[model samples]
Target chain A: MKMKQALLTLTATAGLLAALPAAAQFQKPEDAVKYRKAAFTVMATHFSRIGAMAQGRASFDGAAAAANAEIVADLAKLPFAGFVEGTSGTEKGSPKANVWSERAKFDAGAKKMQDEVAKLAVAAKANNLDQLKAAFGSAAQTCKACHDDFRNP
Target chain B: MKMKQALLTLTATAGLLAALPAAAQFQKPEDAVKYRKAAFTVMATHFSRIGAMAQGRASFDGAAAAANAEIVADLAKLPFAGFVEGTSGTEKGSPKANVWSERAKFDAGAKKMQDEVAKLAVAAKANNLDQLKAAFGSAAQTCKACHDDFRNP
Candidate 1:
């Protein structure tokens, strides 16, 4: 019993240690870009999976949807973090020079997107195909609005 | 004939006017983040849409796909301009203090993903579902790889 308790304690400590860097590490622009990109991609792929499930191209795929919902929930938190100012580093194909110039407006957009995505997570959790569809559409719209004004497209 | 020439002149002028801002705007971190978020969201959303089409839950939706492709192709260029050094500002959620520090790797990842998506666009033009599936999967994988190392999750 004592050995099992010790092992549990060790595992808990390791988990805690692992999380420390995640918070401190994501502070860099490159890291923020990486983190947000990762979360967005995961959400995107799972969203595709969910689309598949909804269309019945695949079955209910409850397991996949559940997994996807979990990812979406996490993604809701990422963009705000992506807004961590000073994180922007020189990349090969970044946006216009105006992004840094228009900081207030940009942050507002990010916050708006995060709010919508958060709502999407709730709808996704319900596992109602219709709800997911509606929520996802709304979230995608928020993404588009920001992209239209700020993104290169 | 004079009317036609005038129309031609106007169209050309409009095109130039449109192109000019893409070259001129968004110099700060705030502005860059806003713009980038838009581009990234468009890319992610379109990516999901293509996956939907490939799964056959939806129709070809050629117009939507083409528009999205155009947006993505254009947005791909935005990041390059947004990364000017010293432009990085003090945003709360964008990334961190380190993004500017590790700009090269971030740019590379973005490029890889963009290239993959461009491949998907070609497949989309062919309207070949199988090709779409293959390319989409490839593109998504790049997205996942970046996210795994960079994102919050």
Candidate 2:
């Protein structure tokens, strides 16, 4: 069982790394860290715009929701590339060490979020408030799940 | 002539503001500043990847160049939204006062950059290194023009 689990982890890690553009894209570990954080910041800003409409805090504009959702989906593919090895931090809101140790699980979470956001993008384009709300909830849950599992509190 | 230029600045500022999603997207001036900086950082990262290929510092990968150029084009529409009122700074690399004081000229520069990047995206899709290089040089010049005119030294 231990050997099988280790093999699975290796496969998962390789798959995740293969999805990245190139290690050369980031010349230093710090660059990777900064890139990932900036990606998250931009993604979150757009995501929150959708959240505002879904929660009734802001008026529902289908065009705006669709635009924001599209940006979110595009950005979803980005931050994972920045999760280079040895860059996990102990600070609050930072990725925990398990991001590397349990690399497969972390990669799974990233994939889940991306999948949810992609769905959210499609749903937002439907121009129905109910559909946007449902999709936003699912996507937000995926974000929380990863933060709970892999990020420091 | 001074009055004519003032009217033009007001018209340009209004047009630019109208293009943004809404002023309510940002809760505070700092948020706008941070959001814009994050957008620029992500855009520059992708832009630099293309630059590497264009300058022959890295191997020319047509597909990669196309992907980077597309991201740059999409991002060209974003950072300008973050240039809210009273956010200009005097520090090096910050937006100069002229960004707001000479709003029309600044907006023109922004549009020029967007146009160049859009062309770069199309050129990159041709998958010809020469075409990519030519488009990349034009796009880079737009970036520099804005930086030279609107950004502080």
Instruction: Give the top-scoring candidate (TM-score).
Output: 2
> Highest DockQ: which candidate?
2
**In model 2, what lDDT does residue B85 have?**
90
CAPRI tier of model 2: acceptable
Local lDDT at A136 for model 2: 100
Per-candidate interface C-alpha RMSD? Answer: 13.9, 2.1
Question: Each candidate's DockQ score against the native complex?
Answer: 0.02, 0.47
TM-score of chain B of 2: 0.86
lDDT by residue for model 2 over B9-61, one digit each (tens)?
53453354347554577999888898889889889999999999999899999
Instruction: Report lDDT (CA) for all predictions.
Output: 0.57, 0.87
